[model samples]
Target chain A: MSRASWQAFREGAYHTLPLILGAIPFGIIFGTLGPASGLSVEATLLMSLLVFAGSAQFIALGLVATGTPVGLIIAVTFVVNLRHLLYSITLMPSVCHLPLNWRLTMAFWLTDETFAVAVSRMAPEHRTQFHWYYLGSALAMYGNWQLCTLLGVTAGQWIPGIENWGLDVAMAVTFIGIVVPQIKTRPKLLCAISACCLSLLWHDWPHHTGLIAAAIAAVVLALTAETMGQKKETSLKTGSKTT
Target chain B: MTEFILIVGMLAATYFVRLLPFALADRMRLPAILENALQYVPIAVLSAIIAPAVCLPEGYFWIDWKNPYLMAGLVSVIAAAIGRNLVITIFAGMATALSIKFLIV
Candidate 1:
């Protein structure tokens, strides 16, 4: 490989290793649960490939297990994945200059992990290359997900003690690790707390609509807190001039 | 026929939701309030998933010494917040959860 290509490949590999490791147990759990959830092997594998989202796919699987109506399941999945809209919005300005094929390919691989790594590392100047890096990270995650799901499906019941293995906590831990550092302000803290409370209160809502509502509530709360903070700061500055 | 239609509809709906913001951002200038709202999206979505998973273990709201998952999750959150390392935090959380499950239940 050329020097730049090698660097990109290496960067992608290094960035994706942790995500793959985190995803393995998750994939295995999904595989183990798929049959019990009444999903055929082909359907399970297809869902993994097509959805490629860990949490939302699990939520969909749970709904499917309960024999939810097809329309409700589809609607819930759509709502559960609404956060991806935010992701695409954040990434578009950075990746717009890329070729159409590359843009679409990167879009296909866009998940929380890949987007996190890509957005965090993107520089203001070399934003064009952000898509390449995103492609590398996302493609690596995609490969791991496919392989792990294949392994899980083939092994099936033979893959013992997956629940006991504590793989489910991996995603939560990873999320907390990613999000805690970013909660550097009061408004962000309020957003987190309010969202958690709202979701808990509305957990029984059908189609997981409570989640979407909680997300909306958090954004509103944060915006309000931010505006109030700004007003206070402005008032303080004006009062200091009189004093 | 129903299953096929369901899958197609799901694919369309998911893609529409994912694409909507990008299309809007391209066509119109978003207000500052909307931009700030976007900033809270990740945390809100994440907490929405995490809270119920941790708080409701038996399909109901039950919190007590018997529930190790919640205890472990709390510890895991604290550790992650303080440690800020993905591998360490995950390992700590998993280990705590497993140990608690085995010991308590």
Candidate 2:
């Protein structure tokens, strides 16, 4: 409520503007796919309101369309969102000193975009007002998502066969955008390759179990690859010292 | 009723995964191996999702060049690697898919 907090909040929201723009199509695509995938408008809106995790929601939609069990869907949602645990760990230093209510609200609002904007803008001295700036970014993204979902839902109803038009390519491509940049190292690249290939091989598995299996396999493989690389480097250094 | 339960379950799963870490942050000491594993979860899960959606767009093995999703997905991957921009990657993929769908195949 103070002037400085208000200014920080505005700056946080402003810095997040580009990310908000990137989310527009993504949000609309979710909205349209919800109804098309046999979800009621109420349920779709409520998912956006409550779950609020885009990738998980998209995966849920795909599973729901295939009549997968709700338990499996929720499990997949949990696995897909495990990355949030890492994000919270990284931001813990910045937010640990805050009150319970502030931390809880901030945790709920913590999306990929807000994390990027908040982490980059946070300073040790500005710790007190940083949550306000985070609030700005979170609120901006939250509002933008809800608005885009509404538009897509309305458009889905108005546009005939829009769902059949393969709007899911948006999600596929978006996933590509997300995964490609993160594949900088050999371990990450192999992880992605293994997951991609395994999912395809097990595509017909019941209950969408293939996805979970593939994800688990990829993570384990990456961890092993990383450990092996570390060992090789250490041994090489030791060998040079002895010689 | 089923939908309601599912949504509540998802809400609980997502919210708790996020909130529990913060509440327990003081006592939490994630092992280095666990941290490394967690880092790869996003890429692995997302790649799992993307591979099926693109490679089997029609719910079968459609790896042909004419498969619009496959072509566009490749384009998007290139765009993402080269441009490293979300909007451009999405636009490039969308443009390629739409063109191939309407014009070529």
Candidate 3:
């Protein structure tokens, strides 16, 4: 609300400009897919506004199209979004000083892009208005997503079977883009590889539960890999220290 | 009505998952092991979603011999790894997939 905070906020929004460009196609696709998946326009918009998770929304649409039980749909989406918990954990130290409401807003607005942008922008430890900057980025992404969803919904009616045009492949590629940068470590690479293989192997599982199983497997493997890594690092440190 | 509840359910679940950590993160410290595991959640989950979607586009168990989706996905991944850009990765993947799909299929 202060001038400095306002400026930080605006700057955060400005940082999201490139991310917004990437998000436009995704949002439009979600909107286009929603109606084609048999969701009413209102329902699709409402989902975008309230749920606000692109991947989860897409999974929900797939499950809904298959007439999967509501409980199953909810479960699948919940598991898919469990990654946000990690984002909050990563971000907690940076914004721990903020009040509960601000924290809640940040969490609600947290997405892959916003988290990546906001975390990078929070370098100045002494700065008081980093939360405002985060809010700016979050709000920018949030607004862009909703607008693109709206456009996708409107464009959906005029375009038939737009969902079947292999666009989901693009999403898969987007997943690759997200994965490649993060696999800098052996554990991360293993986690990614195992999860990918298991996902294909588990593809036949009922109720789309394979995703959760694959994720859990990946996490378990990653933990094992990381613990071994830590042990090795500590031993090396101790060895060097003694010598 | 069912759709609305589903939407609400999704909203509640998403907020709840995203919110609990934000709220509790300050109150409690995550264990070191748990913290390390949590770090992998994003990569694991994204791969879990992408692998099947690309490898088995048609159904629970399906793989085309040439696998245009798979081929295109690999191209995209290579493009992204080399370019370090999302737009280029997506466009390149899309372009590869569409061309293979049209040319071969």
Who wins the lDDT comparison?
2
A87-195 per-residue lDDT for model 1 (tens digits): 7776666655555666555665667788666667556765645655666788788888888778777785785776555567666666666667678889999988898
lDDT of every model, 2 decimals: 0.72, 0.82, 0.80
- Candidate fnat values, all: 0.53, 0.75, 0.79
TM-score per prediction, in order, is: 0.87, 0.76, 0.82
Ranking by lDDT: 2, 3, 1
List model 3 lDDT by residue over A25-128, tens digit each: 77888998887788999999999999999888988988888888998889888877876766777676677777888888888888877876666664556348
Quickly count the clashes in candidate 1.
Answer: 0
Screening candidate 3 with a backbone cut-off below 3 angstroms (N, C-alpha, C), the clashing residue pairs are: none
Q: Per-residue lDDT for B39-103 in model 1, tens only?
A: 67777777776787678855588687556657767876888788877677667767777777776
Worst 10 residues of 1 chain A by lDDT: A95-104
Model 3: TM-score, first chain: 0.75
Q: Per-residue lDDT tens digits of candidate 3, residues B1-105?
A: 998999999988899988887787567777776755666777887788788877888874556547777887789789978988877887888888888777777
Off by over 4 Å in 2: A1-26, A29-43, A55-98, A110-137, A205-209, B1-10
**Regarding DockQ, does 1 or 3 come out ahead?**
3
**TM-score-better candidate, 1 vs 3:** 1
Error of 2 at A176 (Å): 2.2
DockQ of each: 0.54, 0.58, 0.62
